[model samples]
Target: MSTVPVRTGARRVLDGLTRPAVAAVTVTVAIGLWQALTVLTGVPSILLPAPTEVAAALRGNRADIARHLAYTGYEIGLGWLTGVGVGIAFAGLMAASRRLRLAVYPLLVSIRIVPLVAIAPLLIVAFGATLYTRVLMAAILTFFPVTVATLDGLLSVPSSQLDLLRSVEASTWTQIRHVRLPNALPSIFAGVKIATPLAVEGVLLAEFLAASQGLGHAVLQAAANLDTPLLFAEVALIVGVGLALFGLVAGYERQRRWSDGTDGLGGFGTRGGGAPAPTPERALFGAVALAALGGSWVAGTVVVPNAAVFLPSPSAVAASLWETPDLFLTAAVGSLHKLAVGWALGALVGGTVGAVVAFAPRTRPVAGPFLVGARVTPTIVAAPLLLVWLGISFSAATVLIALATFFPIAVATASGLTTLPETHRSLLDSVDTPRRARLFVRLRYGVPTVLAGVKLSIVSGLSGVVIAEWFVANGGLGVLVNQGMRNLQPTLTYAAIACLFALGMVLFGGTTLLQRRLDW
Candidate 1:
């Protein structure tokens, strides 16, 4: 009996260790396969280095790599902090004073829509290849998510709760602390999670544009020198750092949930699982916001000269729109076509792949790691290699965008499908629903999640397009902006920028409205 007890304890230890052991084996197999492929191709080492070679390079250059990592990390940390801080401050300001939100919202939206890559080079030139440029770019890229999400979170506090607080004569600060802050935790955390990865990626982009130090600059140098092993090593480090940062944010958010009365808010599980308390002032605030925005537009147009050289009036832009309707419209149409096709194809392929792997018992183990890889690999770096392989064609651009946008949709869709309500699944089984009907039910329940992912993918896909333009393509907005900058046509560059923002807002706003309609 004592011997049997020992055996049972050993078995439990082995059982507990099984998954990790399997994971190690999987990684080993992958590395072996990667090495086999490299040798089989007999290709230049510069094109696709073996894993061992990359690891060796990384180890040999640890000091240099560490320095670069630290520099890049600093950029990301500072920029992320600044963006989140400013975003939260702005959100609070906007929430407290509707006029401020309205006056600045359009410009903020416009700034958000413009691709950071397009303006990064300009910032580098202006800021003189310093850390400030990278920080600014990172801040610009991450700010919108935090600001928008925080604003939504703050404004999303329920009217009934506010009334209750008021009934107890809570001060504004008291209400915010006791009511709004808790309610906004989920949204703010969601934004923080998004900003986490973006901050890292944005810093890399800015460094690539113009940095003497940092992992991004290292990658660029390695690529330029055809040192593929070093390039991969740098990329790997960046990815690891990004994943670490993202994991930190996610863990903190999880802890926040645990500490916040098991639900995000205290006794108000509203938002998704529970009925969200309606904002008492949403309608009135929205009206005031729009009015203030319109007034600013009027002021901008009326007070600002039509041809202000650097900053043209809205009417001037409208005239420019008319003057080169074909140019703007055609480029927009081309971009949109590319975006829609790429996003759709990526979604279809990714969703199907995720679903199949998730549903298959054996494949499920692989799915999680695969998704993580896809999620962390910055798709922008792939653009240059893609351009090299495929040339400056629309196909290259579309493929880049597709790959960039696919991961989120796939992950979210899989998550939704895998976590269906037990009651709903039980009901379907009880009704003896066919496989097709069961799948349909699952999909319907997952639509909101799918849409949410798609919306985010669209946002991400636009960034890819901008990156694609930076490397390839001769006639897109990227090309136009590049040309304008090369020729020192600030006005034209700004004009193109304005158009880009308009295009982005159109896509974003259109998708938002469509989602709302679908919800209805």
Candidate 2:
């Protein structure tokens, strides 16, 4: 009936508002609680200012926040754009040239192992702590993921598709634009999504290290003057900008999906941008993988024997897994333990907050500020304050790591739950499903996104743990890397970095396999 269509449209509108309505209500309640707790705890404003006080400071200092925001945004925007462009181009080149991949892959892998923070100081010195320095820092932070994601995506395209294009004798440019580019779109977006936050954080880190005007510099200045309210305001503003940018990117991704009849992942068309058509050369990848391993082994053994330095042979690294094994074992175990604890803490906190918001629409308004606080804050900037409060210990490091890791998973979970298909919800409703049953059903439907969030959280938490160690830990790879760099031991520094990358690959690869196993 005409009335039914009208009701359906209205319901869709209401459903669209459901999650946000809940988020808004939650935010309001949270703010009220925060204010009451601050008063009850008698926490110094310097340590934990009331929400009202922070709001007042922000209202009064709009111009200052604006000025710093503009400066920092310029760096984030420029670096992100440049990084994506270069990453796409390089990734394409890698896909097109096996020789180039063979020649440079090892070096690329090695460079990726070095923590950007460790290299940041040297970049600042080289670039003289200017806007250029900040841009370079952000770009460096952004490039790897974009490159790796795009390369993986492009190569993942079905070979049959390429053969069809070749059968038609597509021009090189045509092939790239019509085939590879479309195919890589999802990977590129994945990279962009990952890079967006990192570039913003990197800009802040650079500004904190050295800048005349920017949110990062302002926060440091406020800290130096012991202006807690002002510091919190600036921090809040910076984080708000980051959240805004992140949302912008997500929106773009969604739009692309809609336009392409895909989801967040685009480029799965037949000839244009569709699911990679069957590749004729599927077996090539297996051969390439074997060849790469063989080359790496030979390089480690024969190549190292003739090289100038005592290059840790592949055998040495493998043997180190047992010999001076403590170095490898201790480092691996220490990092893994931190990663596990951080991931678990993040999952629990983020899941609880998200579930509460999903169920309690009225609390969204109260949670607004806290969500922003979580999203915008770079864990690095907060490390100093965390040090003061939690002290330079594992607790502080773990908390910082947890904070970095939690929000994405929470946001993703909330989004997935809220966006479940109407038919599925209606079917459950028709059955008069219990509330607990509904929750489980929703969780099952949302597992893919939840898993993605988990993977992201793990990697981000690992990065946070490393950064925290640089400032706060007595041990761990980060500490070792920091000490090695301080003592001018490039090899040791590289070794620690190598270990970090190995850890990342293991964790990331492991999660991927688990995801596949779980069909997430």
Q: Which candidate should be chosen as best, given lDDT against the real structure?
A: 1
Give lDDT tens digits, candidate 2, residues 1-520.
7799999996676566755575665667777999999999999998889998999888888888888888888888998888888977887887677656544444454345445665554455444778988888888888876777676677666788889989988876677777877877766776676667778888887776678999888887877777788887887677677778767876897787823222222211111221123343324544575577667755765654433133335544455444555775686578677767877888899888877776777545556456655765577777656655576788877887888787877766665566567999999999999999998878777776666566666667877877777665557777766555456443455466668777876776676577667553
The global C-alpha lDDT for each of the candidates, from Candidate 1 onward, is: 0.71, 0.69
TM-score of 1: 0.82
- Model 2 accuracy (lDDT, Cα): 0.69
lDDT of 1 at 148: 72
Model 2 vs. true fold: TM: 0.71
C-alpha RMSD (angstroms) for model 1: 5.6
On a 0 to 100 scale, what is the lDDT of residue 112 in model 2?
52
